[model samples]
Target: MGKKINKSSQNGYHHNNHFSNPRSKTKSTIVGGKYIYHGEVTVEELAGALNISSADILKYLLLNKGFYNINSTLDDEIIGEICLNYGFDFEKEDIVEADDFEHYKIEDKAEDLIERAPVVTIMGHVDHGKTTLIDTIRNSNIAAKEAGAITQEIGAYQKTINGKKITFIDTPGHEAFSAMRQRGAQVTDIVVLVVAADDGIMPQTVEAINHAKAANVPIIVAINKIDKPGANIDKVMSSLSKYDLLPEEWGGDTIVKPISAKQNIGVDELLENVLLVAEMRELKANPKRPASGTVIEASLDKKVGSKATLLIQNGTLHVGDYLVIGTCYCKVRRMTNEFNKPVNAATPSTPVSVTGIDGIPQAGDQFYCFHSEKEARAIALKRAQKLVNKQAKNEGVSILNLHDKLESGEITILNLIVKADTNGSLEAACSQLKKLQVDTVQLKIIHSAIGDVNEGDVILASASQAIIVAFNVHENSLALAKAKELNVEIRNYDIIYNMTEEITEAMKGHLKPTFIDVTYGHAEVLQLFKASKVGIICGSRVTDGTIKRTSKVKVYRKNNVIFEGNLASLKRGKDDVMSVKEGFECGIVIDGFNHDGDIEIGDIIESWGQEVEKK
Candidate 1:
């Protein structure tokens, strides 16, 4: 009889001899006193080498860090994390040839002529009728009797117009777009750009167009608000032409439809145009093959528990399936719709919510189907190996320091995420960064998002290996902690040139020189002019740097750097002045302090302030 292979049996190997495999034993150097599988090795192979449960190895990322079921494409973000946490590095393998991307393909076996519905995603400026357009279509398609016709959606809804079915993904206008974009699943069949005919193209409209173009998806122009008296479709079309999106009537390939979602006109024409594009592109799917796709969106829902909504472009998704998303894998214990309703299976081109998986997956994560849980585990192991090698190459980042690298053409460029509170601030900061220069290095604005440095921007910066610079924009307080943990450097600057100049200097390996100014002066509590728990009023003279009121101060009694604190209060004879210049006599007070014997009329005092002048 064959040996009964069980997880327990594979995990009880010799611990010291765990990494005996040639692939993973490249070097003896250890990160946390444990050997990482520096090269490709099977999970089973690793489990035995490490003398730990296969499940345990998968749990923490590797060798008992404790992570599990990371095979499900249900999320890729989690998988990358799991891989990294366990000494696996996916970034190392990011440069694989385009050919390798389709390496592990699974043929769809489903006979279902997956007439992939034309997925028309409406994107535009804020307050544009994106939601209204989708809603009107959904309501129009319903049999007027489906009384409770989709008052709310699970992110998307399907509607049939002119007997052609289309699915519209209601992508958020902000914050969420990047997550959705990152999934690499943005195969927009047709992008219905909602340009307010009167308001014309806005900044975000241009961004949306670029995102769609980057995805290489077709676009369909929807001139919204044609019903309004102020609406000027001609002006909007002229502006769109600047972005190369000429209307069909103007001899461009792009289709244009003017409709008022409020009045619900020209909706049918939009559907027909989308289907026409789909047919031209020959969008087809085999539902029979193993399911694979990118995650639409995922959230750690309190009730659903790691809820993920996936838009399957091809193949069949069934409950009880195991899958790999990026580096993480998961078991599909439950399949559902965005509504949280249980379903037997979801097929190609269908959007469904799923429950399962060990953690929340990254939105837009590419998912792939595997032969089984075992195969998924094996593949994940291989992927993890490739990542480890990649990281080893990048380990130079810490050793060389970002500054040194930038100084040398060896690291000629640095990327930054530019953010600010308003459009003007954002533009000014971006202009400043663009001008920062060195011999060979240049400051590049890879991602410039206007608004506070929110969590979405934080995640993107982390993924892109970019730094965040906030100009007049306050980061969400909560992100500060996570940013620190990720070692993500976030710099805050109120002055535009100061921010850019520092970044430039740092990149050039000549960061602004740090200088300290010392002050020589003293203040004695004079008759307790005023006393409080904060400090006691007194008189003093001749503090260096004119004794800047806001300058940091050290209240030293015996001159041992005592009372390391700020000079909370300063006064010049009740005039609230900053400096008692050199020999000029002035009355001053210390906040949150009182003197009894620390000083008499001549108790010596000294102060200093740091000035970080740009190089």
Candidate 2:
């Protein structure tokens, strides 16, 4: 074993015999009072430069930093410290790694740039005629095919207007699909915010405006339902002005068009305006370069395997091109247009349904084409490893670590999802949470609604890195399980004071974990009976998981929690039982609920338990 040297006293080794001696055949040289090293230096190369044996350097590092082999490359910091010990400054040749193909910055010459169609995204509240507008423009009946006439997923389509092509991305309008809407905004160059003339501006309409603003894109308001009897264009325009989207007629740059999507009234003018804006922006891309763009959407088909919809932003994409998308690599076997027509190649702003992806790439993930399969595969493997490492490092932000994260500049915004038993409570909770913002961090409520926390909430929280605050409302079984799987934090609180106080303390880095409610199962009341001995009994059918007699029960009427207490009795077919599994009918009685009409049919009875969350 060699003698270990203290890292703090490393400079004292300058006059030692190991470094003072000169070794032949060394590549390093000292000039202008600095030791110049070329490229990355290995342990053996460093030892040779110091005129010392490689074993001494390895032993010293093993005793201090970590073990290293003779051939292992030394980091710049280690090389610098070692050079300082030899009475010289250090300088290494700058070595650049392989070009980051995924994030490669392409600067196309003006001569090589050609005009490309503008990518437009349609966003608005539900039932605002957004899909109808797209259907009218594209001459497709996609709205009729959707379940409940609501677009559940993102759909990309291409339409030609006056000899010019335009790409349209139709995003879901429901509040639950906020993540999808956000993704749509990011990849769009222009946003067509459709506001229902009858409904004016709604919650999702405001959300769409904010998303578009955050994306720093131009907005064109399409006031739909003008042909309806209740249409009010002026009211809608005035509402838009409140969001700082003033119409051109009102001395602002925003273009407002009155269109009846169902009647096809003023639809032609909307397309005209889209083209006009595209021309003004001078959208251009070089189609001669290798293809690179974002994945609009992806899915797994039972017959075709993994298929993805790619929006080629620049360069031309061919059928046989090798692509590395996120962590998946694939050789494009086939490509189809939005209408499912076979296409040989796609240019900028073209949306194509591509097949042969090894794995499903997430929506909004960027993809780049490579010349060789080996290079694409290697890049994909490295990306997959990086993703695994990142996931391991991300523990999912929670209130307990909010202050620490803010102080460390890890995050500047705290996103929250608020759920409450009633509209009043939801409003109050959101207000209090917003007021908890400090100077260093901002609090944004991405979604707020009245109901038990559900799977949709957990999914949104996971996507947005947000925490769910349940006020007087608990998460359902499915939501609780999904939250754990996604590492989403759902904080439950019944008292407004405690909720605000604890959040304040958390913002100040003083909060601690307490007992949290755990949901066991839920059952729906099928019938109500007036029991002579029990006062009132609920004939219920277990809908999910298992309900036990010892678990505490809460009465939920229309997604609102109304009562909470221990169960009076649990019976099956007039016989007492300890537990009832899912899909089984049983009799339930609340200990404190005595009125015969208190528990009504169609109401939900939730069984829950509590456990302490240790620090």
Report lDDT (CA) for all predictions.
0.60, 0.78
Model 1 Cα lDDT, one tens digit per residue, 456-517: 56655544456788888777876676565444567889987678666766765665355656
Clashing pairs in 2: none
Tens digit per residue, CA lDDT, model 2, 366-466:
78776557666776876775565445345667877778777877677787888898878888888888777556667887777778998767766766677
Q: Give the poorly placed runs of model 1, Cα more than 4 Å off.
A: 1-118, 140-154, 160-165, 181-190, 198-219, 238-256, 276-288, 297-307, 324-345, 355-362, 370-417, 420-451, 459-469, 472-474, 478-489, 493-615
TM-score per candidate, chains pooled? 0.53, 0.64
What's model 2's TM-score?
Answer: 0.64
Best by TM-score: 2
Q: Which candidate is the best by lDDT?
A: 2
